[model samples]
Target: MGSCIICGTDVGSGRVCDSHQEDVVFDFRGDSPNGLVPSRFYRGVVDGYAEFGVFVDLVPGVTGLLHRSELDRRLDTLDWEPGDEVFVQVKGVRDNGNVDLGWSIRQAEREFRGVLVQEPAGEHRPDEEPSDDGDDGDTEAETETDESADDDIEVADSVGDGESVDSVGDGESADGDAVEADADPEPTDKDVATDNEESAEVDATLASDGDEDSAVAVNGESDGAADEEVDTDADEETDADRERAPITTLGDAIGESIRIEGEVVGVRQTGGPTVFEVSDETGAVDVAAFVEPGVRAYPDVEVGDAVRVDGEVESHRGDVQVESDGLVLLDGEAAEAVRRRIAEALTDEARPEGLQPLGGDETVAALADDLLDAAEAVRRAVLESRPIVVRHPATADGYVAGAAVERAVLPLIRDEHAKSDAEYHYFTRRPLDEPVYGMDAATNDATRMLQDRDRHDEKLPLFLLVGAGSTTESADGIDLLSVYGVDAVVVDAAVADPETRDAVDTLVSPELADVDGDEGLSTGALVASLASAINDEVRPDLRHLPGASYWTDAPDRYVDLARDAGYDAERVAELREAVALEAYYQSYQDKRELIADLLFSDGGNLAAHVSEQFREKLETEIETADANVATEAVDGVEFALLDTDGYTHRYDFPPTPLLLDDLHRRHADGEPFATVGVGTDELYVRTTADVSVRDVAARAAEIAPTADIDTAGVREGKIEFLSGERDAVEDAVVAAVAEAF
Candidate 1:
């Protein structure tokens, strides 16, 4: 009458069949508490306590508080992980068993909580022999733990995941992860029939009875021929049913570059570790493997189902791993997905240095910082004269950005083209829109406006754009040159991304629009008296001008001249210094001569070289001169002069008033404020109160009543107005004067 959990048979009531009362179960880990906080799992973690110790349950409703004490041992270090499985046995009781469970791990190796396996009896009947499978054929086992699969042993034809290492009872089929704990069927007739009703127990003295060749003698006498054949067949089937261990060396899976084919034995979730046991034609190993992102970026293989990994294998910590350089996918859908993964991985590699991507763990603000910095840098560089030719562009943020680049860059270019005065000065490779460039526009337009450059005497740049594409791209806006109209369009030369910022940048090209118009001069009554200038007035003649350089050189040259004079003093004292100074100047003069000669001769090679060398030298000299100028005093007027309204004088003096007399002389006599009234022969002093004596009073704008300022408008007194309308002029001037004050 023994019905116990250990053997699942009836034992006589009251006494435990297999229990040893002397051993105490000390490891009484109960179910974990309701508040047990489990940490999220990931790779590379050492299972640290990023949190407090949690209570892990071993039995229902009873939790054991996992503490550092769990690692108490002679080793002195708690290096083992909570997930690592170890077997320990209970040896004795502790502290009167009052909640303190002390156990001896050394005594209970097989008696601990694990699969309880029943051992075969010592004695057997005369004809009894266990079946070949060593256990019931239908019985299956499942694992609650993992095993090292590196260089894992592969079955001759195949292998399954999580197979048990040791055989259980006879006739037991191979164990696998799919071997449900309940996969074993109820007592089959085979098992029931094998357990004889003839299993009559004798007295205790008879327990040691049956032994020695009784089975051989009984079978040999009854069926000698038949028994021999049966034994042979049984032996072969038993051999086939034997299970192989599943751990092996990583080296066996790989060698140079041959493909290893096997059916897919494992399929981890995508984006997770790719694991499977691959077998060769004969045997195989369970491989623990992964592809690095660089390999992932360009992977050419399918995983999971079936794969032939044509890669190198390596041993990482005695674990076998497939070191794949690349993969080839045999399946259709899997192949596409692998390619996409590779593409994604590749794109990640191409991100600019120092730019970080948005990892899942990153905060929103951090991502914002990256994006903001990229946009601002590009924008700031372009405006600050140190623009860079970067692939990534500023966002389509139409904020108030500063650039002297014209508000109407297209119309201005068109007008310049009509007058045959447009000349695009090329500044290739470097980015800066300086005064010499005629227009303050992006080099994006420099190409298209090439045809308009006054190449009659000047050589224009023949830009050969280079980049990732084949043929010239369609010139959206940037032309080749003003004179050349548009240079060749090159596509793929510029990197394209899904971001539309490049689109915004491309817009810069079209700002150099086609201009074909007639020449017209500005003419008006007020302009007629001034310098017989263009439009017959005091207007500036700037149509054919090369921009501010024409105006700035007069000032810059004086500084250069002063430099020579200062250096001349030093040179005069030392002949060596004089020679060196002379040589430098002569070299510069010679280089300038070369450039001039090249320009005049139109010698392609000589001109390009001299131009390049001159620019380089000029830039260096300019920088050195700047350092020197930092110490020099500017030549602002000393005792300047006065602008007199014929009566009063206002003196203009240098910023530094080193000499006071220089200021006094400027206000002396009518030499400074001489005024004799023209109409009234009266000599009056011009003071702030003498409104009548002011020049603007004498030139109080007079206009036709028939024509309104609206009809012929311009700015007045720093405001815009037209001579025909008095009211408009008064309003505009009043506004301007108020603003100026």
Candidate 2:
């Protein structure tokens, strides 16, 4: 038998008595599921969620299902996110090694009277005995409770004497009289009013006398001058006690007050407090100050102001935040010093060591300098608490590139900020329907950003464009962002327009690196290397992405890289098909979770399921288009022509561009060949011979003067014309392709 940790009641076999079993929390340290005891509370971390229940990990490799039926509220109403530490009771352990859990009303460790570690050997209280240094093993919860009780007594005593609690203790008077605590009863309203009137009369006499010595003699009678001096000395002593603490070190100082000096990067007004997101050189944290419920606090503290915050550190819903006591804005030399220190630290932390391209692709390696600049820009944005917005084309290669960066930057955001939802707030991936960053996309982005800045006082976001913003066609859109002082970085493998190099802040393109244009590089290959530079800890998760981006003829190095990362060539193909199919359907949505499962999950079930649909849809479209193909000979170069509007499903899967690519591969023979798929107002040109879509459009316009021909997508060789001039435009495009060959 043992005594209970709480209330000292005797127990039959455990540390907790029968009556207090639910009052004490347990930490499961045993290996097997059978070690869990029914009706006993255990701490667990949220592993993941399913339709039926939430999976929680009591220990590594030991998970229990918290069924929805056991919850007091609806499953969807639970605000628990993955990795949160929660409390649940062990309901039962099935014979098949499944442990079932029931919801516990008590969630936090402090809510329980005591805590015990349940191990295979026996149950014991954590650090139960005092150490060699004469320190008791008191948990933080117990210490906080004791401190709170002491503060209540002090507040009560101060109220009885009409003095502030913090100013109660000080040095003795000049005559060697020690100050003693008053044992008088609490003063009534009449007594407080009489004391206030006397203080006001004394203040007026001191101002009228114009004699410092006489005023001091009069003030000393009531101990008013001595009280003022003591308050000043206490304020100075408090300031001296506070050393500048780094934002990253705040977690260790919970329940203790400290001073933090930083710039206010963002300010948000909530229902209870005004939260200021402050960032020092090391990290960023939210400091909340309350005037009243739903009322703004520190109206003078705006974003970009260098300020010092005095607050007690607290943990609110798994996020470490500060409860502000005072906020003082710094200016002149003080503000300059803070700004300089932050700038120096940011530069040192943001600069990467060197560029090591994934798969050792020489084409990407040649652009190391440019890639490093883009990486530095992204890293600095995270450090400064600036949001990052990524825009890419709705294609397999584009999604892979965006997802690679998303996977790398998310962990950094989680580490840099104390908030669990910081990753969702800081990083966003937007997919563009077209391959160009046109005016419509830019206007939408600008409107949303302006609203965020106005409503939440958030900093302007850095726009990262992958696979979509390299050509001159996107110059106007990029220029629009520049007008708002928003920075943009473009990473694409396409042959960029020469003038586009001057449009964006940072441009990473193989063509700009002065390399041969025959590398056949994809956007995913370049951005995956860039993502590695942003955060190298996530490099392993990004190795297979470069190979998965290519539909055909991926480089041997990338294929080998994928193999080493546990992905075979066939698996890479399936992932590519699945992402492409999904990208087409949603086209606009990020599809973050579904895409992550397909690319990162250990099981191949999801990929196989999605890839099967991809193949079935693609093959059906190819078979339909094949029967309508018409062959023609122009200047000894064979051209396959198909009227896409009449023969293909215009609005369904296997989009026109993808279908034309597959049809060209199957029909292209040994001789020089080109495939021209013409629609009502647009046409796509695919050629084996060397050709430029821009040049082809220029030549076709001259051949058919009334057709109004022009290139739509430079990379895809897409040209647009009037519906009435479709026949003329089609004939002219075929003639131009033959002449180029």
Candidate 3:
């Protein structure tokens, strides 16, 4: 008898009980298919290929065919090779004893939770005696030489009627429920322990390199390069080489020989050259090293090593790159000198010279320190050649914040990098379904960045969170980036919690600056000021963005600024409507060119056309919602309740929030009224009075303590509660609004 490792259930001489066996993945230790359990996962290696399918070896003699029909995608696109390891699931044992294998999407070991070692039954335990058949003795003798047994399976180059085979011995049949008596002898306890240890080590090795599709080549091809760097006799020559060549910035030396010093961030192999991505504080450029065709030159060089290079500047494919004539690794005083020089340049160049917020609003002016810090982080990312990923909510205000940053940073990226498409390569703007950075968004971002770094040798991205990622809800997403040493800059106009301050490298918000009436300041306003600090030359173009973000009543300063910039109230409304319409479709794409034209162009043809549609659709939805609102008194407070799902066009351009905003504005009739747009399980509360949605949600919870109410979408004044307790939550919210009034 034996006990299961997971649940401690007594089993009849096996590692796990039959009930818990399928729950854990097993490493098949035996050499035959008779020992493998059906419907189980196993690690296998690609043995060879055939036109019809790929041959996979689970153990030494156990082989199966992964047919082209079972593949999730086209087989021709697979990157697997003969020696690459993959994961597979056993479908069934056929009547002819051939094992049918199923395709697995998770090819890496990290995707599996646990791995157990499986052993044959009734061979070593005291409770179960070994079989006395002479066939068992012969099976053991055959496996001794089975290491070369797979050589007989010829690999066919084209599709033909090739019969698949399994390792089931003569004593086992397709329907055998128990272990066959002629199976190989069971491994000893010590042997099992050793196998488990070895498996663990292999799994750890694979997991450590899981960020890449394959392993990284840290050790370069050349053997004598390390010796050359460490030679004691070369010290004087190295010092003289550093002194002979004058150091120059990559941006300044376009077509001349210049000596530059920086850290090597990435190393990639090309067909004829080894490209080393070198980054100084000023900018990053590719430095090509040529020892011979397809030979890596610097054998000793690795990522994170500081080096000094004397190279001739040349442009490759319209992008500036360096052709290395002489390169040497720096150490001791030389390395420190490079580090200090880069640090000084980062501090000087990260923020714009003589930086100030775009407008003279004192509330925003008070946040200049944090605004400059945020801009500096973004600028540093640009200089370091890291991608900037902007995540914003799918709203007009959110798009405004995201677009402002995109407008300011795109020009700077173009001016700084020699690559013409650097703007597209380095910047991406994604819209969130809601204004919260949860696990799903974080996992997606991390996966993309990791894959980009692994597959293309791209640097990690700088995540710029606009309109979202400020509350405590976003901590998990931010922490995920911190694990990879990626920095996030959070620019929110909401009253963020203090805990968020600790999560991000830079937190820019009016509440953090102790500004009262901070709710009036939108994310667009904050990011507009920040965008100017990033690039002051784009200041004039971003004047209309802040006003466009305010749907109902814009602050007079931004309104007057837009007017002075030739965007009157009607023209500003046109741009606002045009942007709002574009924000709905393809929310994932930034629509950079179209947005730039709408917001920055002096001519109003595009804005006038799109805004005419926006105004028509929005006014129709408002009139429809205004007819459906029912007035009632809750705790003597006037309440206008509208069924948003029934009254508003759910799929229309002007979304529910904008529709509700216009409905309340045009039909309120001068009453201190609270408008509640109730959906199936969510409620949106908008009032002319200054009432806190967070406070109302708290009070609703107090009124119905068992309703399990939550203040979801707090920035939009939305609440989510149990649909069964809809009446109680509505009554409590109305009462809370009365008290606030």
Candidate 4:
């Protein structure tokens, strides 16, 4: 009978017992189907897709079929493409040598408990414990198969990658070899050899036979004396070992004894141990501290406290974990040193050098300093490990800007935090229906932040208002965050009121530079520039975003920039339409992965495919609206009106605003045209003339005192008043327009 490689239990033949077969993965080195291990997870690459299922390559010359019947969801919804790395389970090898694959929910490597290197049967067991006495320490006693033996292995240090050896056996060692039961009372770090091997062996023999006093009678010494000697030696070794354990990243520190310094992000108590999720900037890992079962260890520690820990790295159910032996909370000088180290690491990577505006507008160019400040705020939030909340208008332009920041910030968050899901927790992009940060949006944000702080102990998020918070209309919303001292940054292309300037901590606007006319830039263009300042590596990716925001008469310089980035007018338009359509569906969800693919992936042709559907649906709606256009002359000012309730598909694709935008583009031919599409109780107005809806609403309210006219949307150039006084409001609005002309 052979001993199990993992737990040193008596097994019939194979290296691993039945209990551990599923928990471990073996790198199959043999050439034939006979060498394969069934019911184990294997790293695979997505080779291609077929009508039946996806083909995954587990190794070179070995492919498996992930049958559709085993899928948890529909195959078409899979975000995976050809050549992406994925994980699958090996179901079985058929008689014909074809491997059947089962679906593994985990797609990333960080999802596994622990990795074990399994060699062929003929190879030497790398984990075989060596004895200083030059004797093979395999005793004649029956090997224990107690699963609880794993809990007996005491590990105090963690560092490095997957185990090159095997799991521990009996109580000899934790990894492969560290302590030996029969070696000595004071074992060295390598072989755990005792100077008095004869006496130690006698004690081990009596202990194994379940003797009471016989175990303590060895070496003619008392039990207390032996225990004292063992404890003293172990303490001295551990003290010296702490100084030599090198600092490394969590990803690189798996399965090795090492040291780590980080801030405790969270803490949870399992039935037997308290797990502290620690983040050291390079990554995060859970450090488990165990004193007793069902008891809290390190009760003085709280979330956000800096700590220095020494532990043996291990993986627990796919997550990298540390079995901590020493955990010290830092305070005063030590704590300040950790904070300073993190800060230095964060600020060392400077923003792109000598960044410039994507367009030729001097006004936008002059706001470069303010843009730099805004980018710095974002970078600071990430470095400090604070969550960032981005708010943008629910329009094509707003989405473009929000997406640009998201693209730049996500990679930074990933680099700054070790957890794979850090981006989801650290950064969020939320879309607002209106281009105004009204009290409703602000109240929602405040409520969630307060709850997160109270329950989860989360830091107050950095509010990034892109394309939506630059007007006095959003003062109440911005003021809400200020009440709690939450820092906010505003980046908008439109001119903001003086009152709005005081609400935010930092505001970046082209109008602040006193540029002439409104033709200088789009909000998306400005945000793309700011995003470049935040992360320069993504500058090339953001070049087309600016041009995509402009629907008509986009500046020549911006268009040329897009062309230089390999996107011509047609490609730019396609991207804009694709983003708009995606924004319309699941408008609440950020759709982060999907949007990233549509924007950053070079070969997917996702934009072209989605754009085709967008144009077909949009053109159909526009054609219908055009056929129903009602023309009138209000005070000799040409007006184009469409009863959207009667002409447009209210609940379908090509939403009313997009349909109206297309209608205005189709009808405004070299004339000052104002197009109004009136829906149920609301309306949208688009004009080729230089008309301010805010000014028009103010003037129209005076023309008709009871109309209650106000600018419903500054970006859409829309006016909202009492629906019951539609005729009066429209007439006053028309008269106001005529007076301006």
- Winning candidate number (TM-score): 2
Over the stretch 1-741, how does candidate 4's per-residue lDDT look in tens digits? Answer: 554444455666544667756544455545565566889777778899997899987776788899888886557546567787777788999999999999875443433332444444432133443334432334444234222232243222221122111222334443546343232222223211111211121111111112222112112121221211222344435543554232335556677877777777766654345677776645556677654333456677778887777678875545567777557666666567666776676676534454576655566667777888888889888876788999998778889999999988998887766555668778988898778889999999999888767755678899999988888778888888899999999998975776777778998876665656455578998899888889988888888888999888888888999889888998888888888899888776677777777766745389999989998888788888888999997765678888888998887888787788878887778677778877645667777777777777789899988967777667767677787888787778777776666
TM-score of 3: 0.65
Model 4 RMSD to the real structure?
10.8
CA lDDT of each prediction against the hidden true structure: 0.24, 0.79, 0.69, 0.69
lDDT per residue for candidate 3 within 583-656, as digits (tens), equals 88776667777877877764989999998888888888777877888989765567888988788777767777
Ranking by lDDT: 2, 3, 4, 1
Model 2 segments more than 4 A misplaced: 1-231
Instruction: State every prediction's TM-score relative to the real structure.
Output: 0.17, 0.72, 0.65, 0.69
Which lDDT value does model 2 have at 200? 17
lDDT of 1 by residue, 654-709 (tens): 11110112223222342222111111111111211112222322232332233222
Give me candidate 1's TM-score against the actual structure. Answer: 0.17
Model 2 C-alpha lDDT per residue in residues 226-246, reported as the tens digit of each score: 222222444446554668899
User: Per-residue error at 442 for model 4, in Å?
Assistant: 2.9
Worst 10 residues of 1 by lDDT: 393-402
